[model samples]
Target: MSERLTSVPGLLYGGDYNPEQWPEEVWEQDVKLMREAGVTMVTVGVFSWAGLQPGPDTWDFGWLDRLMDLLHAHGIAVDLATATASPPAWLVRAHPEILPVTADGVRLEFGSRQHYCPSSKAYGQAAVRLTRKLAERYGRHPALALWHIHNEYGDHVTECFCPRSAAHFRDWLREKYGTVDALNHAWGTAFWSQRYGTYDEIEPPRTAPGPVNPTQLLDWRRFCSDALLALHRAERDVLTATSPDIPATTNFMSMMRELDYWRWAEHEDLVSDDAYPDPADPRAHVNASMNYDLMRSLKRGRPWLLMEQAPSAVSWRPVNVPKKPGLQRLWSLQAVARGADGIMYFQWRASRAGAEKYHSALLPHRGTASRGWRETVRFGAELARIAEVAGSRVTAPVAVLLDWDSWWALEGADHPSARMRWPDLMRPWYAALHARGITADFVPPHADLTGYRAVLAPNLHLVRSADARRLTSYVRAGGHLVVGPFSGVVDEHDHLHDGGAPGPLREVLGLSVDEFWPVPDADAVPLASGASATLWSEWIETAGAETVDTYAAGPLAGQPAVTRHAYGSGIARYLSCHLPDHIGDVLDAALAEAGVTACVPVPEGVEATVRTGADASYLFLLNHTDRPVAVDADGTDLLTGAPVRGAVRLPPLGAAVLRRPHSPDSLDSPDPANSPDPLGDNRS
Candidate 1:
């Protein structure tokens, strides 16, 4: 047994393989095609609970054993799943209580996947039993490389309102708070005369006439996340105990709010993510890069795996647009540009029957003669050319702050505005950095910020005293800090801070918010800096900070819209309104002040990133436009044997991974006159 995912050379390339769906005769052809595609590994038995166990007393491992042997003979590794993602009809019929209940009090039947309750005792016991069974049988199997616990934990059933879940929620509350009095105080139950007398009276925030207590809803979300995490831990413990050398993991949906990936990453030996960036979105690459950066930062810059993606169009979305020619290869390399050790997809072959029958796969229904199959083979060969990129790390000098607790708190029912979506507000900041060719890593509020030159907190709406202290200490220790609007307004318990807005951060920022003025009905507030803001505005009365920008024409015309405070050895900047246009200026000023430079200068749509290894550094330049763009570089392109001297012209949707043996200074930005026109129309 090996600790890593595979022992073969090069980056892993493969997808989920369900051998049971096809006849035994087709399995040989599948392995031959896998070898041709340069696939080193494949995930097996993800949704095979029914086939693996025909009945409670009857067991069938003959088919799995033969498939494992067949794959091993063909020199392909296996990421064997525990086959507990979807329960069989027998289990559900035996204990119908295992089925999840919606908030509207409807017991959901079990036709689709992920239909079990997170807190069901019966379900947990059965899942653990199956995990132990698999581990015991495959502990010494030659093809086993990694153990995938279960498929996407909180995808369909994030929270359950059944009686079993209510009981589990009560138990979780007791463990977290220890007493009814403590729970009431933490939840602020005194509001709306909703104080509880005992723990037995608590429920899972079921459907109510009026709005439920905000804190209660927050706690319910926390408990639901924890309940799902407990299931993963239970199954993971069996595998680790059975085969300690083999690492265990479960696929994570990128930026999923249901389960906290930061907390979940702590339990994983290797982090793997499933990302689907819509092809219809023109700027989908920008947001997809943000998720990739988050995956890299989850385990502190460890190289993770891209578990699932569509080779072409996906079947789920309404429109279901196909990935344009060369788009899949471009985005796949983009993942490698960030930090993905392996590239995998949902299914190896297209499904002939099922809900996802129309979903794209490496081997489409047209088989080996189709363009999709040709592209798949080409992509695999491209991955083989850059095998040295494995085990390298990407270091970022700038960090963007994201906290799950804050995200759960900010999106409650009763808020200042219904338009304050976390992802929408945070994407702009990341896009600003991306457009400037500045690579950034996502960090939590309490993460170690000493390594970063600047830290951007786009929206930390819920911050406790400890989180505030960490930010203050980071700024005092010579790190630039940027605080966004509607931040520091509430504590961890969903209770408002006593001192007002920017509560614990008031002293560091040197300002206090008088009131939040959310602009109504498509109105823009003009700023003295010649830029306009929309959606949100805050009235601030600075005590010791300098006003950098102010409201130009409004009731609070002379009020400060942006302020800067000089702390111990650094500066703290605050934006009181949502700056849709001028955010780049604010971030550029901060980056200049902190002495942070971009990796390289390129055209507007081009992306630049670097991955450093023990012996060499690789610079990735991706041209994401319809025309060729020129880039200055001096290295060998790994994709091609050609040597790049002064500059290289990349064709439309082209990519180049340059291997630099020495001279790290090549990453520094060139002089203004020598640099390429960043916003010019470089139409080749």
Candidate 2:
């Protein structure tokens, strides 16, 4: 963590504040209200591009200057935006080519946010111009805490098929393959007659015939992510040159499919995620926690910021549901307990009129008298008491492998079936681990695996040679591993591996697949342990592995469904079939074999997570159940500040933070400048 983050007095509360939306009088009232509600900082100028730059080459700073000074006067820090999230009407009118083109070649009209194409030279220059201006103007300002770059990239437009982007994509392809022939070989263009004579012949895989070349699609995804990351890097360089002190970052939509965050994460000084879990799902917290862990893992366990979450209800969903009285508090702390240093919401005061008028905020449209505002105040005050947790980190001995390339390629149209999803399969395993009170970090294929005692890989279908070798080395080095079925079936180029499926891992997995059964037309296939599986079932034969589970009935009757292979001091558990949401019994046995155990067992729907501080580990027990749960643990409960005996009781939607002794000082992170973290020491 940087001093810029830890220098704050407490958890950084508050969020995107639109002082421009209200009158000057209301601005003062909002500041007072924010301070009263324990808001330490606010992100300003997120959507103020149209307002800040009314015309081409025009700049307006009168209203914004006063607001910044006013916020500083009130002792509130500022996460200032360059207001380049959306290009102004005048700029888009002047440079119409900056508008992004859809896959069908339709130019997206202006008025909506993020309409500019990332590869447009004009758009890139204009964005940097505004950003440099902001850095120069507010570099040393008292309230300037951090620099907020352009809002979420590729959220609306993942890739633009415009000529500019196409040219950029071709350039990227040339850089990767060195020659058009090499690219053809990698893409396996033999069957499709896609042999390109020149790099320029390639275009963004846009609206192509029958799903497009899977390799080209994956490359297009890579290009889109790189193009936007290039923009961020350009602005970051400008900011660093002008400011020299302020750290730069952008908010990431945790689970957004566009833009490979695994690659984008390296450019950030510290990671921040905007999460909005569905209230309709009873187990929304599990999904939220998974995203949090992924965000924290982006920086390799560095403290991250909860950039934007709904204070109460979100407006964009089909049906807006208000969070129950204490749900907001429960969710916000959920992020913190999982290694987030700060907690901020989408907005401060609710908008009086706009597209997001219905979106909840610290001070809602109903004003401070409402339940939303009261809960916001209560959560903020609670944050004030726990300021020390800002630099602390949660220690987990398990890692869930996450690969963006694999995710993109695994669900390609040319696959056996499109019924499977990478996140869908990974979520169940993560939830099973989380249920056991064993928090996990999300690791990329290339990340160091020494710290983790075990690694769970749900579906790593698109395995690169180097990465496959890395996994093999990890297993040989005494690291327990769990491999799901249908993995390692394809090389990095999205082509089928030679000979058969489960290519490089055929040796490591100690099994070979002769054929794959698609689970009764995408329905569940019964297993011997009473567990059911969907998506795929591989007819397998083990070389030197032991069968743990088998199919009860089917043509592949009594076949190995799950296998265990011992290598070095570790054991590899391979599930030769897809699994349903419920795999508790199997997961429990796997975890136990790896010597991983939960801090304490809780009733269903209750979560247990541990964050390590300087002198002790803070155990967070969250009760998501409607009924009260009995918790058994030792330590001082932070919520009540009381001692807990043998079995303490927690009400529904309640939480208890337990402080217990552990290895001292858990604050450690790989510096942003360090390309690969070599200090792979496990904290606590």
Winner by lDDT: 1
Distance from true location, Cα of 428 in model 2, Å: 1.0
- After superposing all C-alphas onto the true structure, candidate 1 shows an RMSD in angstroms of 5.7
Candidate 1 lDDT by residue in tens digits, 131-237: 99899999779999889999999999999999999999999999999989999899887788888998899999999999999888988888888899999999999
In the range 1-684, model 2's lDDT, one tens digit per residue, is 352363566578889998888889999898898889999999999988878778766888888899999999998999998888788888998999999999989999987789989899999988888888788888888999988998887778777889899889888888899988899999888866878888877888878657688888887777888898899889989998998777788999997776788778878888888999977788899999999988888877778999999987899999989888789988888998888889989899889887899998888888988988888888888888777666667667788888888888887885677776898888889888877788788888877787677889988988877777777888888888888878888887888888676788877788888887776574677888888877778899998889999998777779999999997777888987778665667777778887887767888888888776556667788888888889888887776778887866889899988776653353342222332232243211
The lowest-lDDT stretch of 10 consecutive residues in candidate 2 is 675-684
The lDDT of model 1 is 0.88
Clashes of 2: 0
TM-scores vs. true structure, each candidate? 0.96, 0.95
